[model samples]
Target: MSPKIHFISGLPRSGSTLLAALLRQNPRFHASMSTPVGSLVNRMLEAMSEDNEYSVFISPEQKRAMISGIFSAYYQPQAEKAVIFDTNRLWCSKLSLIKELFPGAKVICCVRNVAWIMDSIERLVRKNSFDVSQLFNNPTERATVYTRTEALSQGGRLVGFAYNALKEAFYSEESERLLLVDYDLLAQNPEKVLSLFYQFLEEEPFQHDFENVQYDEPEFDNRLNLKGLHKVRSKVELQQRQTILPPDLFIQFNGLSFWTTPSNSLANLIVAQPK
Candidate 1:
């Protein structure tokens, strides 16, 4: 059987990494930490002084070559079930090229509330992964630019962009196979959410332990402190006020809030009580 490919798309710090880590524990699945394709593409763009266009001009032959190389390099041949999960934040931005590479693959969109996502990203900036100097360069230009900050602003604007892109894909002749999973639900009811994921991939659920899933802790030592990062993010949020996202994206991704509600009977079921 041809290897199954699952594309995990979402804002950074929105739990895609956690999901990938959990999925990798299953014997049948082969998942990698965020691959170099995106970073490579970004470097290429910076080198060319152009926006993302590496995949745009690539011929069909080249596209196949690149995808095959990525697969062979990242995926282990011994994986029993042969499902390859590509966890990349920029995959959604390059949906067209990704489709060309893996036509039969299933797209799994992970979403979260914009505010919380921004808060998380702000924390990330404190860790020094992004340059805070970009925030002050040009607010309008920066808003349109794809900084790690813009990716984290999980509110309406980012969701709207993703929604419109997915809508176009689904409506297009090429997209009958995309699935969306809420990040909050996955965190709250991992077993149930993962069961659905397994069913979607047509794989038998493995009897694996979820409690031991290793997740990296958020670190802070970058340019901005928590207070400074939030202040800058607040400024960006103000500039983004007119670009609100659709309500459905929020509804679909806000499952975490619902699961946390007192009356939801399952509230305590999957939640880990603090010691």
Candidate 2:
């Protein structure tokens, strides 16, 4: 049997990277930011679904297993005993498929206010003074706050697509399989929040050194003009950050999160696996 694995998917810049970095501190865990599992599945479906001669030769079952084979191949390098956490935003959209592929797998979604999610991306873009971000794939297009806001929320970007997909998973029959970890809660009280997460995953406690965590992907960051995009803090404590976005602009996406609403029964749930 393949080794156990779960998924880390949620709003970009909402701490998924930090969560993965922390999880990897456990020698028994294998975790990383935005792994290719989701993308591989998407690419395979795109190629095989075409109405061509090759399409007739492949069965649906074969395709499914092949998609899973990608995961098996990617994680084959890890110790056979390690539990994996594959991170990707597209995982949010494939709820039914993921449930079938990894029956007991839980998706940990790091969330902040929608407005702030947008704000975080914008802040990074602004930080790269000379290098325009390839975030939207238009490096030369210097986007303003208003224009960027529209573009992010309207298209294939993280905040828009994944946010919608999360809502779908939250309301599905598999809603119990999703955990929404708020950025503020994770920032201010990681121990409390992560305890719930570990409990949900049914993992034994690891003596995580919150005081010293290090992660960076400078090459990947440079490709996108985000030099320090993947940098993680040495300490897990919440540091004060005043949003560069205006109050009016930031408020636009404040209430977009369902977790903060009264009807959100799954808010901050530690585990979504069935008992």
Candidate 3:
């Protein structure tokens, strides 16, 4: 039998990579940074869509099987593991399709304040110093923190798409299968968060070493010219620091943490206490 599949998704710079690193410590689990399976599944859907010349020859059941086969084959090497946690930001947006394919699957969404998320990205851009990021189209878009954040927050862009997709799943009819894990909460108290996380999945708990966690994708980061983009510290704890974003720019995203509004969230959430 194939291992149970769950997903790690949500905002960038939000701890999904760290969560994956911690989860993989479990002998029965397999987890990692973003995998190619998500993109492959999307491409498969496009190929089977009406735009394809042979779409008339494909049936819905066949298409489903083909898509399902992607996961089974991609994780075949880890077939011995009892569970697999696939990481991808786009998964939140496709909750309906996810449910259709894996009815028991759950999505663990790692979230943080939008302002901090922008700050984290800006920090990365400044840290690389010499390399230009492919995240933006051209030099004009990367000219300033304001321009960069603006470009990133466009409805179709990176941060914006994930935020919107999270909101979509947060309030969708399938929200029950989702769990929103705050980045601060995970960083500060991973054990507590993992307890809630396991309860949400109804899976038995496995002890995770919060102090010695490890995960990094240097090649992937270098490819984007965003070094340390997916690096996790050897220890799990929040670092105290002031924002590099200009005051005005940081404040622009003040009220975007919609998950804080209890009335708007239907999914289970594990968040930090208000300061």
Best by lDDT: 3
Q: Point out where model 2 deviates above 4 Å.
A: 139-141, 264-275
lDDT digits (tens) for residues 1-275 of candidate 2: 56697888878888999998888898888888787778888888887886566898899899888988888888889846558899998777787888888898888887777877877888788889788767664532356777677777864775688788777777777777788887777777778887888888898978788889888888899998888888898888766778888888887877677755555445345322211
What candidate 3 gets wrong by more than 4 Å, as runs, is 273-275
RMSD of each: 10.7, 3.7, 1.0
- In the range 3-87, model 1's lDDT, one tens digit per residue, is 6777776544445666777776777787654567665654544544436455567665764576566556555563455787877
> If both were scored by lDDT, which would come out higher, candidate 1 or candidate 2?
2
**What is the Å distance of residue 106 in model 1 from its true position?**
0.9
lDDT of 3 by residue, 1-275 (tens): 78999999998889999999999899999999999999999999999999999999999999999999999999999999999999999999999999999999999999999999999999999998899898999888899998999999998898999999998999899998889999998998889999989889989998899899889999998999999998889999999999998999888986688888767557988976455
Positional deviation of residue 41's Cα in model 3 after best superposition, in angstroms: 1.1
lDDT of each: 0.53, 0.79, 0.92
Per-prediction tally of clashes = 3, 0, 0
List TM-score per model, in order. 0.57, 0.92, 0.98
lDDT score for residue 244 of model 3: 92
